[model samples]
Target: GGEGGPNAGGERERRRGGRKDESDWWTRFQNDFPWDEKTTRNVVIGFAGMASAFLYFYFRETGKEVSWKDFVNNYLARGLVDRLEVVNKQYVRVIPVHGSYLWFNIGSVETFERNLELAQQEMGLDSTHRVPVIYGSKSDGTFLMSILPTLLLVGSLLFTMRQGPMAGGRGGGRGNPFSMGESKAKIMKDNIDVRFKDVAGCEEAKLEILEFVNFLKNPRQYQDLGAKIPKGAVLSGPPGTGKTLLAKATAGEANVPFITVNGSEFQEMFVGVGPARVRDMFAMARKNAPCILFIDEIDAVGRKRGRGNFGGQSEQENTLNQLLVEMDGFNTSTNVVVLAGTNRPDILDPALMRPGRFDRQIYIGPPDIKGRASIFKVHLRPLKLDSSIDSEALARKLAALTPGFTGADIANVCNEAALIAARYLNESIIVKHFEQAIERVIGGLEKKTQVLQAVEKTTVAYHEAGHAVVGWYLEHADPLLKVSIIPRGKGLGYAQYLPKEQHLFTREQLFDRMCMMLGGRVAEQVFFGKITTGAQDDLRKVTQSAYAQVVQFGMSEVVGQVSFELPRQGEMVMEKPYSEPTAQLIDQEVRSLIDAAFQRTHQLITEKRDVVEKVGRRLLEKEVLDKADILELLGPRPYEEKSTYEEFVEGTGAMEEDTSFPEGLRNWNKDQGMEESPQEQQRKQCLNTVSHA
Candidate 1:
């Protein structure tokens, strides 16, 4: 019995513990509903306003109207009527001798007035003492209601203004009326992994910029030696030559903030806005010290000033002035390096190119064969190549094939190759894919549906065959790669060639290029006895090349080693630096150069007439002929390699010659017989020579 009693007590205690747990949970659940002070205040304010409105409306609605008979008998008979008021001529407010005002629904003001007067007269009440029935009307707050709408409109206007251009938070630039002067430069401070190793080609440019990076990284080393860091560098090159990429790589290498802005970003519709933006950009660069400020297409804002009075001159001039001031301002100790890129260095303002501004002008031209190979290797790293492919050999082959190709063009070729492989459902990119990509990039997409007639096909075949044969036979001409008659791009035919990877060209080399360019026109004249519009582009190229050689290169004997070409201005305006007689001589020289090249082409094609016909026939049948097919049809070229690719790879082939002139001006001076004092010699070299790619 005692044990059972203990067990019953323990059971009761267990039930109490369960109940306590359940109560704790209930309390926590009730506390979980959040009610912060801010939320509570807002809720209370909302409820208070709603209640005030509700009570006011409820009290007004309680003023119910009495019956008309009751009003006349009880109120009028007892002389208890006090006054009456009208609201908007719609409803009447009736006032009794006692209690609150009651609403009297009436038909019209005239009827109500008539009824009131009759009742007053019947009751024998005077106008002054008989309840004093006032003729005043009740407005029912209509004026206040009318004014409420205007107040709402004003409030809306204020709200829209607050949320409009005056509101500053991102996207407040030229288009924003309130922030027209804000700088559009984008800041990149981190996550930039592009280093010098990733950027290919421009070896000379890379070496030139490496010192700047060292100056930034180890400034004390140079400062101790009393050498001031260069203020800026101007990257001048053709478009797509990797000028902008080199700047990015420099920033990455220096591990500093990169502030980039386009030159056109400074221009605005409003005056002084461009100058303001320039100031703001520099201020931002100053804030982030030891950073690189890269201005892409700087020529857009840095054009030669005072050329002419125009619409945008005032604003652009102010912008250029601000840029000049910022480049060499009093804040020179900030360690900020400015990098500007443009393809038209000739058109830039002279002040912008002077020392202490853009102190270094690095030229990044098209890559040579070895540089192109390195570029190919860099771009080919991520592509899924086939197992059998020799990447190094393929890179060399592509480099050899694509001359005058910039870094951007090579990257595009690599992407195009991958897309072609995917379209053909290949597992990996193959050599054929790369070959097709090169053709596509150089010539353009093949217009397969552009059908030609039999006569047109034969004419096109003969045209391409002429180019191939002429270029193959000429010693200094580019080697023929392939010839095609199938329509591609805007042309009816094309002949691809492998140009030598040479920077400096002699007069003989330029003449050979001109002769090869004229071959197609000569062929058309011989076969059809007339030339068509097909030679329009060919004629344009030959004409430009001949004029460059004469007017720019000083290759013409009549020019006497004097270059009469004027410096490039902003645009081609109506201006001639020379007299009418000199213009005639210039035209005559251009004509003579073209005539000589045409005669040479005619002679070459006339001698090889049978070979042209044979090559043309084969081109018409196959629609395309690669190097191997051309070699088989016309026999091997005079400069054919005695060893194969395997032999060369095995190091048993003939040694390659060094074509570069390391001695530069000295070698060129020796070739051309001229001697003068040092001062005059430098001027002559600068005057006669021009940069050619």
Candidate 2:
């Protein structure tokens, strides 16, 4: 079957070829070169189309003579002959072009001969009619041939311009402006305006700082005396006590470079940044020797290291370590001093308080009376005060009003007084303004026009008047300064006392003070016939005074000469020093003492009923009183008495009566039963009757 199939296919092919159509060759050609396989075929097709156009043009120009020799000589022979000549000479020949182009045909006989000979030898062509060369000069086109080179040049120029300013290499040694981001420690050589004289009420601290300043200025003098200058001084004190001021004053007076930084600034979230900054700061300070580096509020970084509750310590520990090493490692001859200030000295690390580091701790405490006066004088210099305003008297009043106020507090008071005077349109700050300022500072701004009912006003007036009258009668009590029913701050009324400058108080003084405090309640019971809650403050004050006298001052008879008070340790709150049972006894003693004082006040007021009523009535009418009004109403104080007991007896006719008595007076009186009056005889008879029964 397979052998028959080949003969059958041959017979079919012969029959189909015998009956072939006119499109058979075209169809066979298209089958060989299909549309999908035309990528290489397209290039051949394009070249064929160009050749066809050229042939058609050549055929159309039939009258024109064609020179094949010229064509070959001008175009093909120019490249081929140069290569053949090199081959013949056994060396490659190099051709040079004038300017930017080569000249192939110059339209001259010599050029034709040279080209003709070259083409004859290279192409083996006789001098037959050759294709004529159609030579054209190189066209100078108006458009660019390639744009990549220009674009590259422009891009490079832009990059250079952008980098020039940033790299800082274009304009001399003016470095990159962005380099300033790295901050540096600034050591101030001048412009320290604060001096020791400007600081007030810190004489002891100032003296301590002055010694350090002197050491810095003349370290040789101290060295000659075998004294080592302190490595550092820590200014410890309550807030607003001029610690910072003293540090600045030392820097200014010593004429040294000063670097001021807060303790908190050395701490940061980044772990090692703090220590890095600490090293940088000290390095700068050392460069500027004879300098003072002041760290304000050092406790921010100097807290006792182990107390931190977090599992890991703060970065401030690293900073503190750096500070310690820098301070102790530096040579003493370098004259670089570290001054630190902290209100909380107790929480500082023990190592910081050692002999070589912070060797001296100067305490700046609250100002005393004299210090307050000096502080007032310094602050009052700028204020426009009235001529009649005596600073000493004002200072006395201020010292009494402010128990724990510091120098800064006094300055604040003076500023507030000036502001008050300005608010009232007064030309100068007066004593009244100063007083009001003190009240404002102590109790806060007064709530004016807190209107009360007539009954409440009467009660407040009587309540305050009671305190004043009792205090006036008690010799050991503070002298009454003023009593006011005008509502100020939280109180509806208040009574002020001219506090003495005494630092210590006697037992009698404490007793009199307690009685004076109880006077308000006593007056309420005596006049109103009932007590009111208006005596809440008075009772509290009396109770506290009595307890202080009995337990703290050891003034009570039951707890004689046994004080239970402990020394103050700053502002921290803690348990009482005394035991529970001792506290109970103290409480009982305090209550008994206060009760006795109240009884005494009640008796005294009852004895002077007329005087109490008079004072109360005047206070209610005026709503305020000065010391003059109190003195005029209560008469002179008991201490003002100059007369002795003998003088009193002689002046009262007692001595004359005694001298004139009869010699037999005693015998005669016994015989006539004259010794006993009728009242005495009745008392005797009653006693005898009771005894007989």
Highest-TM-score candidate: 1
* Each candidate: RMSD: 16.8, 34.8
| C-alpha lDDT score of every prediction, in listed order | 0.78, 0.68
Clashes of each: 0, 6
Please write out the lDDT profile of model 1 over residues 93-122, one tens digit for every residue: 678778887766778888877887788788
Clashing pairs in 2: 67-130, 67-131, 67-132, 68-130, 68-131, 69-130
RMSD of 1: 16.8
Name the runs in model 2 displaced over 4 angstroms: 1-187, 267-277, 308-325, 387-405, 529-533, 539-579, 640-693
Residues 330-366, model 2: lDDT tens digits: 7778788888999999889999889898988889888
lDDT, candidate 2, at 389: 77
